[model samples]
Target chain A: MAKGGKTLGEEALQQVARRFAVLGEPMRLRILQSLMDGELPVNSLVEATGGTQTNVSRHLQTLAAAGLVARRREGAQVFYSVADPSIFELCELVCGGIRKSLAAQAGSLR
Target chain B: MAKGGKTLGEEALQQVARRFAVLGEPMRLRILQSLMDGELPVNSLVEATGGTQTNVSRHLQTLAAAGLVARRREGAQVFYSVADPSIFELCELVCGGIRKSLAAQAGSLR
Candidate 1:
């Protein structure tokens, strides 16, 4: 259930899960990280992520399909950028959690 | 690569992806949501999520393994609670992204 006494609709819950699932791929995350500074063409993403053009293109399609990225064309080059900037904050929150979890584990070893 | 020109190790990237993958299941999300209020025993979680005892137990084990939830035993009952509260923030961020995506889709449709 969400705020108040109403339960989150099943569809909404599934959508949220799907969003997480889309972000679960390391290649996708790498592509997003590369685009953090600004929009970059597919070739640039391939170079930045050290991934093949085919692999980077595949992940870019996945991110665009998830609405996490937007694609544009400037002449012959196709560029991708973070459509949802909130993703950076999401990564930050997860990173913070990971840091805390690691700290707890380290403390437990002492 | 992260800020300061240091690239995140492959292991760290995989860990982050794993964390997101663990949250990708709707049933797991449901289990976490049920525990949002506080700790609950397996029986209570089974009821709250409307999942069978065996299923809820399995999800709880997965959650615990991920260090997303903590396990406690008292007398004859084992209880579970959120070990990482930052998950709620993560969910909120994903939910916000979904809402934005949906709104944009709706706007484009109109």
Candidate 2:
């Protein structure tokens, strides 16, 4: 994507930063990773992440607030799925860069 | 990119979170946005960001440490550029999500 046409205003920058902060927690990322398969309920997420239900729920709340995941209710159970597919694209881009940096560092060490 | 094949280990999760944290700061994002066009020296970044040289330099150091931006020294001047083209992709993805969320919120208010 072309990214340099205009400078971001302070408010816009903060909104962007807020999105990054939402994705900055390891536990949150774990929860997000689990949801990538499809919609999953809280219990399944807890099992998938091996995290306490309370902890997983807390992260889910944050992720929902950030619009990274969408939640649905069926009977007494709640299911969550990725709110936007672009999230995975973002993850892939960052992870690809990280892999490249690691490869370069290893090359330098040799 | 697919993101759910295997759960990331703790170390890998931290590495990913660290990348998010690096991008979580508004000032650093501003600095990065400035460099999307081409490499620039510290002084130009200071002007583009309306930030002091010391402040801009400090954020640049943090960005470099995180592998988000790269530095090159020529003669007496140091220039900085986005280390990976994927950085812009990440930004675009997050920004697009934020815009969508905002639009949804606005729609609800109507």
Candidate 3:
């Protein structure tokens, strides 16, 4: 935090905030999640995410731009999957964190 | 993905999407970034995150509810930090993914 005897202050937080903003969209998250199940075609993604083909494609583009998802073209079809395995780790960690909070809350309630 | 030999369909992605939705807020991201810097007191968090005291307080509660953050009280002040170190891993992985994407883009451009 200290910089030139003071602080870099807010911009540091803002940079990280932008990353979160990129991931904040529901459609994008669904696209990432679908990728986790396995590499999926864009049409498959649309059906799996319950989003329109146009919306699903748009979200996939957003996700690809963010580096959360990647696509591979084989012949005429492109399959998309989580760009890095670490994303699964993020999902698991967040899921586990949620479980832990629920347990703590139940304990407090009791 | 399988329900009765086919698929659980879309609900699976929706659950994960909601979780991502909770984490996608910028102020929330800033709060988490501050926690990553280290556990911080509420007043310090307000300063570090550049958010109103009331807003910081509200965001912390939302984070607590999401299980992405936890608070410990020492004396009269509450300190908040990432509930799971895994969140840091998420940040790092996502950041790394971004770097990789940039590198790929550069390579392609070249």
Best by TM-score: 1
Pairwise lDDT winner, candidates 1 and 2: 1
Q: Could you tell me the TM-score of candidate 2?
A: 0.85
Chain A TM-score for each of the predictions: 0.91, 0.89, 0.73
Between prediction 1 and prediction 3, the one with superior DockQ is 1
lDDT of each: 0.88, 0.86, 0.69
Question: Which tens-of-lDDT digit does each residue in B7-81 have in candidate 2?
Answer: 566787798899998899888999998997999999999999999999999999999888878899988889999
**DockQ values of all predictions:** 0.74, 0.72, 0.36
Instruction: Assess the local accuracy of residue B90 in candidate 2 as a C-alpha lDDT between 0 and 100.
Output: 83
lDDT per residue (tens digit) for residues A1-110 in model 1: 45552245678789889999988889998988888889999999999989999989988898999999999999999999999999888877887788888888889789
* TM-scores for candidates 1 onward, in order: 0.91, 0.85, 0.72
Q: Between candidates 1 and 2, which one is better according to TM-score?
A: 1
Candidate 3 per-residue lDDT over residues A1-110, each given as its tens digit: 14442222355435444555566566776677667668999989889778998888887887777666778998888899886666666566555555566677788789
Model 3 C-alpha lDDT per residue in residues B42-100, reported as the tens digit of each score: 99989977789999999899878777787899999999888766666656655555556
Pairs with backbone N, CA or C atoms under 3 Å apart (clashes), candidate 1? none
Where in model 2 is the C-alpha error above 4 Å?
Answer: A1-6, B1-7, B106-110
Residue B60's lDDT in candidate 3: 91
